[model samples]
Target: MPELPEVEIVKLNLEQALEPGDEVENIEFLSSKLRTQLCLPKDIRWPLSINKLERRSKYILLHFSGGFLLSHLGMTGSWRVEKKIKAQKHDHVIIRWKKGNFWIYNDPRRFGVFEFGVNTLTNKWLAKLGPEPLDKDFDTAAFLQSLKSSQRSIKVLLMDAKVIVGVGNIYACEALFRAKINPFVKARGLSSKKLELLLSSVKDILQTAIKKGGSTIDSFKNVSGEKGAYQKQHLVYGREGEKCVICSQVIRRKVQVGRSTFWCPRCQK
Candidate 1:
């Protein structure tokens, strides 16, 4: 699945490639089923012009003159810009522009979504999401206040979309490890100083991953079909049983909320 960094990369690429006046020449839905509540093909208004592209959390918000086109690249889904060549088997949605550009949505697992709405903030998925981790509004004081009421593990709290958006499992583990905070530590037990470190680590890890084009662990790829380079720079994630980079202690792996979490036991208290 594409996380915040990956989604932000897509938004940036689309913002550069798609102009304000670019018209939606055509939209083709090859698959009968889309992992969306609303029907995209029928709900989306035709003859729409592109306004801008934005990302909230992991969702891509394509703002058009008429309304918003929301997309969620679920597991194994990607958006690629290609020529007018033959469409592949997994190319479920194709958006052709008037200037001969083709934007193809390929999803092998068919878990991706394409929905239409008038307002993005009023949409079901975007409405309930918490503050974006990279946003300036995510202040340290407010963050500590929010953590005071939660008894969940700090790692789990970071991954909760209702508490903080876009801190996925990989980045959460990496950030926690970088902050020297154990993933299993309770949210309310964290000190203010530790929380500050965790916040900074989260932002740094996320920004660095975005700069490296995000982690291509398994099936993630950018709009240009290029693999990310951040996986090579991972500190603890996917390095279970390996020597810790800082303290030379062996890294460990454990399951939290049914997801695999990696950490350096000695480095991260």
Candidate 2:
């Protein structure tokens, strides 16, 4: 699944690949069985140019003159730029550009989103999301207060989208490891200072992940069909039983809330 960093990379790649005056020739849906049938608003003006691209959590928001295209790369989705007009096996949607290129949305699991709508900020999925970890609006004082009131384990709390968006399973593990905080520690049991450290770790890890083109755990790729190399840079998420890079202690992994949580027993205690 594409997490915050992966989604952000896709948004950035799209922003770079697409131009302001590059008009959309057509929006074609090759499949109707995504998480839901992706529907385009009927009132959209024809041949509109892309205005901008934005990412909220894991959703990519493509701005246009008439409206926006909102999509989520649920588990196995990706967008690839190609001049080939023919759709591949999992290519569910295609935005045919006027200049012979195509923005292809492919998903083998068919669990992704490719929908068009008029309003993005008012969309329910985006509207209910909490503050972005990298945004200035993620007030540290308020976050500390929230952490003090929650009984969930620190890693699980960090992964909660309602509490803070974009801290996915891999990132939560990596960030917790970076913060030297045990994954099983209760949110309420953590000190404000420790929580601050965790917050910083999350931001730094995510920004670094984006810089590395996001992790390619499964099917994530940039808009240009390039595979990400960040998975090779993971500290603990997939390094269970391996020597901890910092303290040389053996790394550990456990399933918490159905997701594998990784940390160093000695370094992250």
Candidate 3:
């Protein structure tokens, strides 16, 4: 699935392809059955001009005059912009524009979400999302307090969407590795210095990821169909048994909450 940085890049790419005044020509569901269930309002009227695009957590929202279109790029879900769209076998949804352009959604696994409605703020999906980790509201003092309250391992705490949005398993592992903090250490047990390092690492990793267009672990592609380049710069996430970049210790892998976490045992210790 696309994490925060990936999702943010997707939003930016979509913004480049789509503009504020672009009129919606139509919305088509091509699949006979879903890779995932599609949620759309029954009375979706067409020709609604797009007002703006915003992202919350892992979701992409396109605000319109009457309502909004919320998209969740689940694992394998991607958007492609084309002047002349040659629809693929896995192309699930197509949002056509009046200007003869097409924004196509392709997801092989069909786990993505497309929810269209007017009640965006109160939507069930956006209700439980935590603070954006890069926001000033998620500053050091607040982050430290949250960490001190959670007994979960620091890695697990960082990965919790309710605690902080967009620190997915991959970035969580990378950030922890960068901070030289063991992933298995209890969150509340960390000293103030370590906690600050962890927070800074998280922001730095995410910002760098956004700049690199996010890590393409699997089949992730941007709106322009470009594979992410950040995976090439990965320090530890998938380098199990490899040498650490800093301490020369062996990189390791452990499963936490059903997701693989990679780190350097010696450096993080």
Q: What TM-score number comes out for model 2? A: 0.94
> Per TM-score, what order, best first?
1, 3, 2
Show where candidate 3 strays beyond 4 Å: 32-36
lDDT of 3 by residue, 1-269 (tens): 78999999999999988854679888888875454466556787778789899988999999897778889988989998989989688998989999888999998998888877687667888877778888866667877898899879998899888788999988999888888889999999889998888888889999999999999989888988898999998999889998988888888897888888898878888
lDDT by residue for model 2 over 1-269, one digit each (tens)?
Answer: 88999999888887777855788888888887699887667777778788878888899988887678888998999888888765679899888888777889999998898777676667777777878899977788888887889888898888888789999999999989888999998989888888999999999999999999999998787887788888998999899899999999999888999999988999877
169-243: candidate 1 lDDT, tens digit per residue: 999999998899999989899898999999899999999999999999988888888988888989998999899
Alpha-carbon runs more than 4 Å astray in model 2: none
Candidate 2 lDDT at 188 equals: 91
- Candidate-wise lDDT, in order: 0.85, 0.86, 0.86
lDDT of 3 at 149: 94
Q: Which clashing pairs does model 2 show? A: none
